[model samples]
Target chain A: MEDNVKKIMHVMRRAPHGSIYTYEGLEMILIMAAYEQDLSIAFIGDGVYALKKNQDTEGISMKGFAKTFMALDGYDVEKLYVDRVSLEERGLTEDDLLVDVELLDSVEIGRRMTEQDVVIHH
Target chain B: MSHRFLATILNSDKVKIGILLKEGPYNHQAADTAYKFAEAAIKKGHTVDAVFLYNDGVINATNLTDPPQDDRNIADRWSKMAKEHGVEILACIAASKRRGITDDIMIDGGSITGLGTLTDIAIRNDRLLTFGD
Candidate 1:
């Protein structure tokens, strides 16, 4: 069967304080899409922490889960996003992030989500 | 806008669909459904442009993943599907970094763009879906 040319979007909402699996799961999908197929990403709620800067995981050293983010460029898996409201709620601004991010409010994020061929929430 | 018109517009050919994964696929059933749905759409002749990974969803690209033999390796499966097809996978650089998903070594296909790219994909695409945990 012929394949349709559509776009996929992945949204993240979990915080980093708990488990790294949530963030990692999202990473796996992006790698698959950017490297293998085609896809994109978005952030909302507590998920904004996935992009914070100077995480200082050294104190806990729980496998350095956030470090995997640097690999995005190599995989051509760009498209990092954040939730404006979520970020503000956590007292985090774009400046506090370790990587570059595009912040969107709930309404804007919702509008953007409708543009994808498929959306998977992790 | 009327539901009929909106549905027609969303379902139009010019529309591209985007899926958002807010939690880890292991914890989120919606994520699994979305992936399956995308594959189904492709088999149905629908084109899936890009699959963006932000926040917790960024973990999908982690190379260190090692799911059990019996369990479905969602990450690897997605990678294989993307490779077989022409799907674009994206990871939120900030989200990944915050969660400690750094690229000590270089991998292919994946990138570290920005949220604007997601917006561009959404605005340009026909449909955007979210599989929230």
Candidate 2:
């Protein structure tokens, strides 16, 4: 039963709603979580905006999926990480994020990335 | 137990590869790159299991895509690859609907599938490579 488990990482580098990459990436993560692979997500660059607080997409005519980040824990996707520089560069902090994530430097994040068998970057 | 490199280390010579394409044809080189990568992998004695299209990538499966006389027909290339190599070229149904791509316009050997199918491809294939932005 344990033979097929894979270490898959989803890397988010795009801003939310600007393009469909990050949004659709979230959808894929939600589904893969059910399969119980060793899944983790690293938010980098403008991808940190995806975890920001109080994102309302009413004007954009798109569904507010920022809240969806909070629901990922329910799907058993608890291993979430954020690039420290990316969050700080955007003038955001842990408090600005909608979810709890480990804020690590890109160096550390890259090390962990090397450990993943499949790394899907969005 | 799972190893660091799952398929390459455990499965001997031939690796089962699954591709996830996120961009469309003509506009970007993503579809072309994926096709070339799959072809190269197959030529090297690997099994190209599937090509799953998402977002704008679903446009690659549409038969309505007709290039000019001098240009390469990307959609036809995917069709031929699917037919000859037995690779499953699938587009996400939700994305296809948003892009006005219907089953009637789907290219030969291409089909519409759900995200669950993508999950299955990720699990079963030895290597799952994602292309595009």
Candidate 3:
């Protein structure tokens, strides 16, 4: 008999994506990893900015928390997904992002969310 | 022990829902939306075990919310509903203290807890829905 695996999904769908929300989402992912929980991230709407490259926080005097997205891969956080429609709406491409991500369509994203044992929306 | 195990198995069909409220009842629309969702979830036969109030949401737990004559007193309404339903309404201790929310009011099932409690709900619950702007 096989063991029941618990899968968790984090859905990011905020606009004007500020530091606090970004930090909270990343912290959740890290904490899940530390506990050996299965975790995945899905970026929707303006939430994609958290993974964008060349984020110049110098003007805002904000801490460089965007760099944490790059460190996600090192934390065994490989399931980074971006909504394809949202990416195109924002005029962004794979090259515009700091981390490599799997672009998913609406149907595929819904299917994935429904398949998870736990789903967290931020 | 077997009966308890059977009950657990039967309840497994129901989803464990944790609602994270980050905003206060100052906005009537947001409060109305949350209440409607909670009502709808009950109507749909899904169990809502807990509601974790964080950040500005600590304001909702305060006993001093007084809205205008024209607008609905959402905070009071939430408190009443929560009391009647026996719902677990946990206000984050760190957030509540920072926002000057003291333990004066008698909000049934609502208490000031820590972030660790929220993390426990996140891990144990089947769905952690966050309500933020």
Candidate 4:
């Protein structure tokens, strides 16, 4: 634990594959992970769809990076937060997600967000 | 004046901000908003350390850009703003190469740098604000 480890929270609000925002957001996260910052990801709104199980992108010709979410632990980016309401709205639970995450309400997530040094919404 | 008001006015904690622009000019309002935000931050006594252009945002640093006579030239605006404020306008090298943004086409006060620079900007700055679609 370095003294200058800044808490960086990346909030993903967009759905995967619909646009490049989520994919590119993930790319940015991956790059920043190498910096050894205290990084956390929050999936709000359609962002939860990014972690849904069994994402088949073969038909769209797009490279499926959904599995990459599971690899965040390897980069020391283990704090994955999924909005509870968002998951329920989409008729999904923790079991539907491909990776293990802390299912929290928006209030808790908002509090955690304020504690961060930087918050990037995508 | 109230104590809180006086405290706020006397506060010297000016945040060092670094902007990350991921959208291109014209197609999105991200560039325009980021430019305006940077301008406002400078005016408010905050130091805008750098503007790291990534993805399509690297296109905003090209000198060969030609906008309509009535339109505001985004590249020219960024170049002039950076020159005046001493803000480093950096475009990601990989993204630039893919988008045909060579050094010869780089605007004044702008340069092509690697993602490592972006990482440094994010780490060094007090706030790393991102503007995109």
Candidate 5:
């Protein structure tokens, strides 16, 4: 029922352009966000790169979607999270990201994941 | 008493499952694994409402896929399961269009649908399991 707002979390674990998973994953997220469900996104591993600042896909002939992350808040899908260990392992910090995301430890992320009604990983 | 009895049955212990497969057949084990999981669940008396195809998973709904004589036809495998078990096998329209999979070429017991349908599957089912890289 629309009355039960589901806690759905989309987990991004892949890098952009390596395959269409991250991009398609994002597309799925946007569509679900319109359902008025409680939605959240988590970036781990290479997925953190999707939010990296200054992505250039012109040379690869791919439509740049990094900027799309910034517009997600306009959809009311504001719970963007990043794995702190994943960012630091890649020598990145909050400043390296193109969107404002909550830096969460693995434990915190796992706890959030457990509370979700559904978790989709890409 | 009647209301309490109806509520008891409505809250059945069996899970209602919805599967999302993102990989194509053969190249990845996601399709096979999802099929087996669905089969096992149905055997255990659970309800497997649908299997939604996204990404290259749309490839699984095409009858044009023909493997060698000795090989397992993955497309046929899905078709058979859908026919025998009455499970809804759906492929995303946008993904299918991108891959050139039209309704005319779709395997038996499968249909082309949209992401909005996927949203329904995710919301209506008790469990939504995703299989992909």
Candidate 6:
């Protein structure tokens, strides 16, 4: 990786489906991944719910893109960090998530966020 | 002489900012806050490269918007601000297509473009600020 490659971090603080922020944030991430930047995603608060397994959106008539998280690695956007406190608060574990993610404490996530060139919260 | 040198340094430190708005007008305060922030940044001698409208924010660029006589016209405000500052007001093509926003229906200074354009804006600008619901 070049020194000029920006470290961009997208912070997902909302749950999926209730609002369009998380879904649209994913869309933005997918686009930015093509630029070959050092991109990472942080799942905090209700954002941890977005990666939950077996999301059935058929009854809600919304497109189920939960599986899309699994495809991010192919685009070279493999850094998915989850907030450990948030997951425990919601009674969710790594097994409950659809994709593999680095479970880090909030302090660690904050440190990484401070190191980013760009931080976008959704 | 020292004050003049400091002023030059301060002026040279001005950053290029790109704003990403993800909500529509009226329903949220994101558009208003973004507009004010853009205005303030420009007043502070910074360059606002562009305002990228995503998702429901495409409505901010539509020409068909007509607020009440007593209300502030959000689209017109964006158009006026863009014209005055030479700022590019771009709405995501995909988002516009879903929201019935076409080229003909866009405000004078606003245009519909692809997400690639947004990527370029983000990469080129020194700061990328996002405002949404």
Candidate No. with top DockQ: 5
For each candidate, give the TM-score of chain B: 0.81, 0.90, 0.81, 0.91, 0.90, 0.92
TM-score of chain B of 4: 0.91
Off by over 4 Å in 6: A1-3, B1-10
TM-score of each: 0.49, 0.92, 0.74, 0.90, 0.94, 0.94
By summed lDDT, the worst window of 10 consecutive residues in model 1 chain B runs over B104-113
What docking class should model 1 receive?
A: incorrect
Estimate the TM-score for candidate 5.
0.94
DockQ (C-alpha based) per candidate is: 0.16, 0.56, 0.26, 0.48, 0.71, 0.59
Ranking by lDDT: 6, 5, 4, 2, 3, 1
Query: After superposing candidate 2, which stretches have Cα over 4 Å from the reference?
Result: B1-11
Instruction: Name the lDDT of candidate 2.
Output: 0.90
Superposing all C-alpha atoms, what RMSD in Å does each candidate have to the true structure?
A: 11.3, 4.5, 4.2, 4.2, 2.3, 2.3
For B1-133, candidate 4 gives per-residue lDDT tens digits of 9999887877668889999999999999999999999999999989999999988999999999899999999999999888899999999887788789999999999999987787788789988999988
Calculate the i-RMS of every candidate, to one decimal place: 9.0, 1.3, 3.4, 1.6, 0.9, 1.4
Clashing pairs in 6: none
**Clashes by residue pair, model 3:** none
Q: What share of the true interface contacts does candidate 1 keep?
A: 0.30
Among residues 3 or more apart in sequence or in different chains, the pairs in candidate 5 whose N, CA or C atoms overlap within 3 Å are none
Candidate 2 has a TM-score of 0.92
Tell me how far the alpha carbon of residue B17 in candidate 1 is from the true structure, in angstroms, after superposition.
1.1
Q: Tell me the tens digit of each residue's lDDT in model 2 across B30-83.
A: 988998999999889899999999999999999987689899999999999999
Ranking by DockQ: 5, 6, 2, 4, 3, 1
After best superposition, candidate 2 residue A64: deviation in angstroms?
Answer: 0.8
